[model samples]
Structures are given as C-alpha cells and as structure tokens.
Target: MAKKMLRSVLFACLGNICWSLIAEAAFRKLVTDQNVSDNWRIDSAATSTYDRGNPPDFRGQSCMKRHGTPMSHVAWWVTEEDFTTSDYILCMDESNLRDLKRKSNQVKNCKAKTELLGNYDPQKQLAIEDPYYGNDSDFEVVYQQCARCCRAFLEKAH
Candidate 1:
C-alpha cells in the first residue's frame, strides 16, 4: 500500500483563546469523526501575545460543550517555525491574515499557506468574529461558523 501523506494545520486568531481555539477543536473533532486522526495534525496559535498561556475563553468552552465539540486549549503566540512547518496556517479574519502575512515576511522559508478559515465555509461566510467582547450568544455563533468551515476544510483535505 502507498503511504498516506500526513498534513499539519495551524489555526490562528488574534488571541488563541477564542476563534482559533474553536477552529482547532472543530477540525480535530471532524478528523476524529472521519477516522483519519493519524493522517493529520491540528493545533491553534495566536497572532498577538495578549493571551499567551491562557486557556480558551470560558464562554467559548461553554459554547463548544453545548454543541458537543468540547475543547480545552492553552494560548501561544505564532512563531516563525509555525509558518515554516504547517501545511496550512488557517486564520479567522482579515486582521489575522494581515498579521500572519506580515510575520511571514520575517521568515525565510515560510511554507504554510496563510488564509482565512472562512474561505472553506460552504455557507460562504467571510470571517469568524472574535467573541471575547461578546456574550455566550456570540460564542455560539463562532461555534456554528467553525463547524461549517471545518467540515468543509476536512472534506477538501481528504
């Protein structure tokens, strides 16, 4: 049998405590559900240092649990190696895209293709908004969006 290709994806947002963490969880769940966890690596990171080492926002945690995609993740800032190592550096919004693009300029062998995670949304939503300043309702929206986009992303990756 031919060896399967292993792919790594790093989901990113301004603070790894919100949308990025949701994306990571959603993607992880999808891959697991598809029984392809061994073929892919999934993680999340931040574009800024504000929430480094912090766990996912409580609201997001509750939202994920409500949707059956419960997750826990510690925040970490994106590094040059993340850019050079990941096959896809999927992000939440324009600010994340801009920040990642700027950071990639500082790295010599950035192999990751940085793009909006929303680009994979079957519903055509353009951005996954940050829910830190909002309520549980906002976090619910983030979960909905991530679920849709992550499903599509995994389908394409397969």
Candidate 2:
C-alpha cells in the first residue's frame, strides 16, 4: 500500500478575523468529517498586518459555536513561503484574491493556485463579505457562505 500525499490549503482575508477563519474551520470540519484530515494541512492567514496575532473576531467565534464548528487560530499575515508551500490559497473576495496573486508573483517559483473561495460556491455567490463591523446576524451569513463553499471545494478536491 502506498502512503497518501499530503495536500495543503491556506485561507486568506484582510484581517483573518472573520471570513478566512470561518472558512478554515468549515473546511477543517469537512475534511475531518470525511476522514481525510490526516492527508491535508489547513490554515488561515491575513492579506495585511491588521489584527496579526489576534484571535478571530468575537462574533465569528460565536457564530462558529452556534454551528458547532471548532476553531483555534491566531491572525497572521500571508507569507512568501505560503505561496510555495500551499496547494491552494483561497481568499474571501476580489481584494484578497488580488493581494494574494500579487504576493505570489513576488515569490520565486510560487506553486500555490490562489483564487476566491467563493469560486467554489454552488450558489454562485462570488464573494464572502467582511463581517467585522456587523452584528451576529452578519457573522451567521459568513458562516453559511463558508460552509457552502468549503463543502463544494472539498468535494471537488477529493
């Protein structure tokens, strides 16, 4: 029997406090539920230095709790190594996608395929809006979107 190759994905957003963190937890849940958690590396990062070293937003945490999804991550800015080490770098929206693409260009031999996470949304919702300034209801919307996109992406990946 051959060993399975490890795949990796890094989720990104401006602050890494809301959208990306939600997506990371959602994707992690999907992979764990599918019994393939051992074959993948999952993480989330910020496109900028904003909120670096901080835990996810309180509302995002509450949202995940409500959905029964577990999340443990600190905000960190995306690095050049991420471009080379990850299989895919999925971001929340167009601005994030553009930031990731531009950063990838600066890294020599960047191998990650960066794109908007919403591209995998079955409902054709192409952007995961930032919910930092919104209330719990907004965070709920982010969770729903992440759940949908993560499930779709995991299905296509495996």
Candidate 3:
C-alpha cells in the first residue's frame, strides 16, 4: 500500500512539472512575438487606468477614470506587457528605461530609445524626457527625442 501511494505522489509531481514547463513556454511566446503591424499599442497599464481599478463587468456604466488632469497627468509607468508586446520598446529617458527593465526579463532588450514619430537617426544614444513639471521648452525636447526614436523604430520595425 505504501508503494502504491509513493507511485501516486511521483505521478502528481511529474504532471505538475510538465504543466509548469508548458505554461512558461506559452508566456515566452507572448513576450517575444510581434504580431501587430502598427506601432502604437494601447493596453490597460499604470497610466491608462489605475488605483480606482476596473470592474470585471462594465455593466451599464463605466468605472474607468481619467489619467489625472490631461496636461498634468503622469501615469508613465510601464508594464511587462509593454516590453513583451512592443516591436521595439521605446523609453522616453534613462529613468523610464530603468523602470521598464525592472518589470522585465528582457533587460538585454531594453535600451534608451526615443518616442519620436519621424526624423531620427541610428548609432546615437539619446534619451527622451517626459513633458511634465519642466518648462514648455522641455516638451519640445521630449518631442524631438520621441520623433527621432519613433522614426528610427518605424524605419526598422518592418
């Protein structure tokens, strides 16, 4: 009887290991595959919708809230999904890159990238900054970086 119980426990352990491996493979596939052709990826992230949280059911009304006061809204935290999904995850600045990497296993893939939509370059390491708290001129700086990085990404993503 003890032998039979030991065999049963061994079978359960083997089943669990196989299941875990399969789950891990599925997760890795989700992170690495860039199936989307477009550059913009908007999902429920820290900045998108936060603390108030979302109801499992939207019901008749919406529980969603604004991301702070538009111009002042600073929901800039990145999620694992961002790194996993973006064809080329672009960080506005070194700080943003650090935050993104902290939530990622793709630290090797994370880089100081701009979010610029067009007019960019390669072989350059420029970090873009978010347009917040700083002077209006700072926003332009952010714009330039974003434009350059985005342009570079667009040129390369295809």
The global C-alpha lDDT for each of the candidates, from Candidate 1 onward, is 0.91, 0.92, 0.31
| Candidates ranked by TM-score | 2, 1, 3
Model 3 over residues 48-141: C-alpha lDDT tens digits? 2232233222110111112111111122234444453454333334553444445565545533232422224463645443333454455444
Error of 3 at 44 (Å): 9.4
Error of 1 at 128 (Å): 0.9
- lDDT winner between 1 and 3, please give it: 1
Tens-place lDDT per residue, model 1, 30-127, is 89888999999889999999999898888888888887887888899999999898999999999999999999999998999999999999999989
RMSD of 2: 0.8
Which prediction has the highest lDDT against the true structure? 2
Clashes of each: 0, 0, 6
Error of 1 at 42 (Å): 0.5
From the highest lDDT down, the ranking of the candidates is 2, 1, 3
Using Cα atoms with residue i matched to residue i, what is each candidate's TM-score against the true structure? 0.96, 0.97, 0.41
> How good is model 1 by TM-score?
0.96
